[model samples]
Target: MAVLAQDGGLAFYGEPDEAREWFRADRIEDIYLRLAEAEEHEWAGRFGAAPAPAPGPAIGAFRQWVLLTRRSLDLLTRNRLTLAVLLGSPLMVLAMFAVLFRPGAFSPESPSPAATVMILFWIAFGGFFFGLTYGLLQICNELPVLRRERLTGLRITPYVLAKATVLLPLLAVVDALMLGVLRALDRLPAMGWGTYGELFVTLLLCSLAALALGLLVSAAVTDPAQATMALPMLCFPQVLFVGAILPVPVMAAPGRWLSCAMSNRWAFEGLGHSLGVERLWATGRSPLGPPLLDSYGDTFSRAPVVDWAMLGGFTALFLVGACLVLTRRT
Candidate 1:
């Protein structure tokens, strides 16, 4: 903590008191600068001789986990307002869809097709509105923190895994709330045990796809503002390819591939299939659309359960692509 000074060509200061005498000589700046250099040298003397960084296996593991956990938690917690907006918007949209298909507004004999269209609308609402919002928010919100963590040696995969873990339960709650609201309005189709099970699986897939896609976008964008603005750019196109508005066959070849890339179309078709409205896919049309009246005629019937296999496939593909991008490219 004390410095020895050179004066008269000799090391002069001999005691702490002697050094203090010079320090109180009205030369505060010079004394402080010298003192700082001395302290830095003293610190170097203590550890600079060591050959290697200290081994920290347990500490390293704990540090890595904490970093990932903290970042993931920060992402969720920081976006409370956005989350509320995203979550609330879906319910409101679903409510609007239900209002459009209120009981007795359509003939009783034609409920299935109408209900089917409404349900697909709800699913797509989940896909476009909630999905894009959640995805964009996750990516945009986490990017800066993620950059900082990467600088400190945190793996993006574990970070993403932690994010997915945190999101699933929250998304489940959102899904449940949406389902309850739709059911309350008698907007949901009645499906049996197997069908409901398939539907649950499909919903989770769609949610995962949304979250993962968001992560991918987040990784690619430098500006949070840009990420936020980009959601509609990514989501609206999904509507055209949803097979409900325009049949898949009517879409050009590129449009067909684009639809294949869209998780929304997959989710809608999967949901329709789960409801036993097999006619939706019989010709690559969302069973929820026009000819909808012909298929159900009036009341709801359990459509054949969705193809769980295909739902699983698309879910895996989206998630895998997300993970790859998040961990490596992003």
Candidate 2:
């Protein structure tokens, strides 16, 4: 046998004349085989010198999360219409509430308990609505792509988390804007920054919990239309049972129990507590204050911290549900 040497130090062992003939005969299979064997050897030599270790699960997972988060953020930013709607809806709500409520609604001298109730409930619900709209279309829109990616080691947790990681910051911005706009428009009472900070934190938690719930619903649904339909179903219950329209104390047992499950209930109570609404109403001269407080029955008397814990619990529960649903579907 004759050894034919290529320029790259790769060699083919055969009769030299036969090798030339093989090349000239238009035998594509022989040419391909020879090239594949050469490439394999090249790869072997390159890898043999210092083999690279495969990434550990933790590292791989982290990398996947980062990439997925970036992709989600990119997608979120590219949709100008959605971004406008998400940011604008809260502003619209702020304007409506500002027009509806007088400036001294929560003032100590002349508190309007009804106004306080509406303010807290609307702000809390605004946060929840922001989060829900942000997350409702996230999973269902990408189900096919996600299903394919899942086959290639894409994890459900990272997918769900990436969606949250991208949207949560936007949600925070929306929450802050909502508060600032309300305060600027005199819909919110003047207060120290510390109290405002507490309120902001409360709203952000509520938004996070709602975002997780939306993610869960998004993961469970098959299409964007279904998720869209779910919006009213989710929001109506949240609106009706959050103890703002009808006090939880006055609701039927089942309705009261259902109110407990609405994240907005905790959010409304938390905002009210943080803003000292109970004190404002209890000591104010408004004739409706005392009776309203009686109906509410210490709804805002608890520490905002308790409401924070409840919101956090709801967030975790919903996220776990979203992950499980994704896992099952994929």
Top candidate by lDDT: 2
Model 1 weakest lDDT span, ten residues long: 4-13
C-alpha lDDT of residue 204 in model 2: 98
**Candidate 2, residues 244-297: lDDT per residue as tens digits?**
999988889999898999999999999988998777877899988778889988
**In model 2, which runs have C-alpha deviations exceeding 4 angstroms?**
1-59
TM-score of each: 0.69, 0.81
Model 2 vs. true fold: TM: 0.81
True lDDT of residue 312, candidate 1 = 57
Task: Summarize candidate 1's per-residue lDDT along 166-214 as a digit string, tens digits.
Answer: 6767677676666656656666654466766666666766776777777
Candidate 2 local Cα displacement, residue 235, angstroms: 0.6
